[model samples]
Target: MPRDPLSRLQWLVFALVSAVFTTVYIPQPVLPVLRQTFGVGEGTASLTVSAVVLGIALANLPFGALADRMAIRPILLTGGLVVAAAGVVSALAPTLPLLVGARFVQGLFVPALTTCLAAYLAKVMPAERLNVVMGSYVSATVVGGLSGRLLGGFVFPPGHWRWAFLVAAALLLAATLAAYVGLPVEDHEKARQAEGVRFRDVLFRHDLFRIYCVSAGGFFVFSSVFNYMPFYLHGAPFHWSTRAVTLLYLSYIVGVVAGPLAGRLSNRIGNGAAMVVGSLVFGAGLAVTLIPQGWAMALALALVCAGFFTIHASAAGALNRKLSTGRGRANAFYTLFYYLGGTAGITLSGHAYHLAGWHGVVALAAGVLLVPLSTGLVEMRLAQRDGSATRSSVARAR
Candidate 1:
């Protein structure tokens, strides 16, 4: 018999991965509510987000390594179950400290879902279709993120903050079950080989190192905006409602298009070119937030999401191509730095917001985008020199 089509399996895994990842971020739009409910300050409530990011950053390496040793399905299922349990614990926590702790635990499990899912997809999908499928996965993640923020904000107004966690838990549980049932079982040897390559061997490759740096920088820029924008809107003249603020995430819909489009565009121009142009677009979008108006702010956020997703999809695809071994570990390392940037950049931006208000936050974000833009420039020049050498070799061969 012909093999079963993997498309359905791909979508199921994507949804499960997205929902699990979204659980970590559900508290972001509700930070103000968390502060009021827990009798804490904004910075402390913000810890609810930063702590989870720290956990993800810390756990990425170990989980990626584990995916190399163990079965992908089991790792993903275990992580999903742990995340669901953490959501329940978060919902029931009697104190802010307890809640933050639960969130940290939830974060710990998330990397298994993220890193393993990517490796699993890479193993199962044809190389030609990898970018398209990965783009869909990225889009699903954005949708989950938007849903979490919107649901959390909406549920809190009626004194139902617990419901938000409960709902997230339910979604995660469903995802876990679907994944357990639907994902095909690969041979353990294949899984190990896919993940088994030594991290040191992978790191020795120059191209992979360049891709990792660019990927890290792209995520750094993306996280800076997502982490800070809600806080900025909640302050100043706008003072948007939880619902209205949650609606800001609707802009992520642009990412649904930008990601796949960027992948296709990368094929034409090159991943480095896509990264450079995308960073420029992202910077331009961040600058637009300085415009005063609810609509203008919304448009700026949409542009940021679109641009960020474009660069993110292309960079990640490029990184996967460059890695010769320990793909899972390499992905984990990429995410480690990615969430590290999120944790450090957002926490620092809190201070910037404290010092300079929204303008300060915008300036800080715009400045951080420079890191990735510069990396992209360096990558382009390197690609050019290599291309020239190849052409010279071809002329001599002729």
Candidate 2:
């Protein structure tokens, strides 16, 4: 329990975030099943998945504002409890409407912790080691999303999606309890020394705004592609079953390694260069999905996973680096756009899937990747300019 950068508190936050994010996608892999079980249409069944994202988009800024004032630990504990309660309500839902309602409530509170984590670390951790901890946290999100998805579609017995909710609730409860017990006690005096960040200052940098908007576009493509992937696999030449389709999410395993690798790469090169590499790789993977074969699709997904995480980790690092002050509000605004992209992706692309088929969705994702790639190129130039300036300054000093 020393005040080292990689303390037990960091790991506790990592674990807690993973558990909280599981709720984000518990119903994702099982959307088709929910359709049949509840006798709802494709769009209606999808509401079970999209509702939570919408809630997260709606709540991130408001809850982010809340995190600026309150201590993060107590807020996290309360949010976890609320999430656990919502899970129980979801498990007991006799109808889809009730289940969607429960998920919305869960989404509303979970950001209470997710939004605060980066800012809290910025306050407490030494600057040099922040990327390692943040990378671990991003990796945890991949694990949680994959875990909840697999739990819904494969781990639980058929017709027992409720068990998935129960297990998720248990994990949430455990993460909350452990965080409360094990996390380092905050230095209230140190915390009080700095009042909350002014979001206006965080936004004053035009470069930061470009990065944030580009991030939203990147996540938008990522969300739409993943949201409708099962449907594509379930149709035509492949005709995969639910379990088979759910197993594809395991490809997200690549993200576990990609997060840290991307972070380290950004640490060496620049965040913008890392982002460009990521976008190129991600676009390549997305393009590969045009192939109609199963193994090819799987390989494509793996590439997609790796590329997406690379962009995600690097972008987050760049954002945090820029927000030397007001880390809380800065991160909150970042997540605000992030989840908003997710909400928009699911809503708009669901219509594309209905009218134009999976290829249309792919086409859209490919087009959207341009926003990030363009911004990433601009960032690379900026980083190069800054580095040259630093070198010249050093030479002059000598």
Judged by lDDT, which candidate is best? Answer: 2
Candidate 1: misplaced stretches above 4 Å? 1-4, 124-135, 155-158, 194-196, 204-207
Residue 243 in model 2: lDDT: 89
Clashing pairs in 1: none
lDDT of 1: 0.78
- TM-score, predicted candidate 1 vs. hidden true structure: 0.92
Clashes of each: 0, 0
Candidate 1 per-residue lDDT over residues 37-141, each given as its tens digit = 988876788888888889988988887777666788888888889999999999999999999999999888888788778877777677898766776677678
Report the C-alpha lDDT of model 2 over 101-194, residue by residue, as the tens digit: 9999988887776876665666666678776777667778888889888888899854788989998999889988998877666666554454
Clash count, candidate 2: 0
Residue pairs in clash, model 2: none
Worst 10 residues of 1 by lDDT: 1-10
